[model samples]
Target: MAAREYGQYCGLTQALELVGERWALLIVRDLLVGPRRYGELAAGLPRIPTNILAARLKELQAAGIIRRAPRSRIVIYELTPYGHELEPVVLALGAWGFKAMGDPRDEQIITPDSMTMALRTAFRPEVAVTLPATAYGARFGPAELVVRVDGSTLDVTRGDGPVDVAFAAGPDIRRIISGELAPDRAIATGVVEVLRGRGELLDRFASTFHLAA
Candidate 1:
């Protein structure tokens, strides 16, 4: 089936033509953190049907928003240079929509990419500036991500690496980030676990990043 186009010359309309389809922007969101193979993308977006995922990938590729490349000798889908330029647009949209979020229910799923991207969305350079250089790790369910802070630079990357502090968190990470639960209390309540390093690292993390209320 042909993609539905807006048939307009407006920049916003044109952009939507390329990415406004269902699951299209979410695919972009998944890749924003980094490249991913087909399986990884599928796993991250469990609700998307397999055929729809494949079609979206093709659409994104045809629009030059994403491209296929080799990572570790395996083909992966990554954003093109033009596609990477959508970072600000995506972040802005996320920030704007954040206020609407309340809480998740028992059936709702929060993907790893969503959490990691939220880390980027909530990064506070002002807070990072006061901190000593360190890397913090959070393992929530099967997903592992690391946050590296140096001076005012904070980077969150997928997968576990050498980190100064590691936290094994439950779905309560959102609660922790939202300040509804203090890290220590979450740990004490068995909702979060300090897998490695000082338990205080959680406090430092809470202070360093914010959800913008």
Candidate 2:
């Protein structure tokens, strides 16, 4: 079946013609964190039907939005060079909608990729440039993320590695990032833990991000 068309010549309409499909932007969002295997993408978005996922993948590929490559003998979906340019667009969209996100419902699943993406949206380059460079370990229950902070940049990746600080991140961390909770109070409540020596970095890190307000 042919996809629907806006029948308009505007650039926005044309761009939307490629990514306006349901779940398309989300597939792009998941890939923004990094490449993902089909199974991993499926796991991240369990609600998307298998048939729909396949169709979206094919559509994205044709639109030059994403490409598949083999690594370690397994194929993974990754963004093309042109597709990588969508980062700012996605980040801006996330920030624009951030202030409206009060809380998640019980059934809403917040995947690790989504959380990392939130970090990307909240990152303040001016604030981060003032902090020291270090790799910190972030564990949310069983999932772990390597969050590295460098001059004017913050990168979040999925893995376990040598880190200067390690901690179990919870709502308190989110509250701190959202500026709803103070760093001292978060620590006092035992919601944010400092497993390493550089505990001060956590405070600096928390200060570097906030919901778009």
lDDT of 2 by residue, 1-213 (tens): 228887878988877888889999899999998899999999989899999999999999999999999998899999999889889989998888776767655566667898799888888888778777877788765457888888787889887888887777654466777787776677778878766657666777677777744
Model 2 spans with C-alpha error above 4 angstroms = 195-198
Which 10 residues in a row give candidate 1 its minimum summed lDDT?
1-10
Residue 96, candidate 2: Cα error in Å is 1.2
The local distance difference test score of model 2 is 0.82
TM-scores of the candidates are: 0.87, 0.88
The TM-score between candidate 1 and the true structure equals 0.87
Let me know the TM-score candidate 2 reaches against the reference structure.
Answer: 0.88
lDDT of each: 0.84, 0.82
- Report the Cα RMSD per candidate: 2.3, 2.3
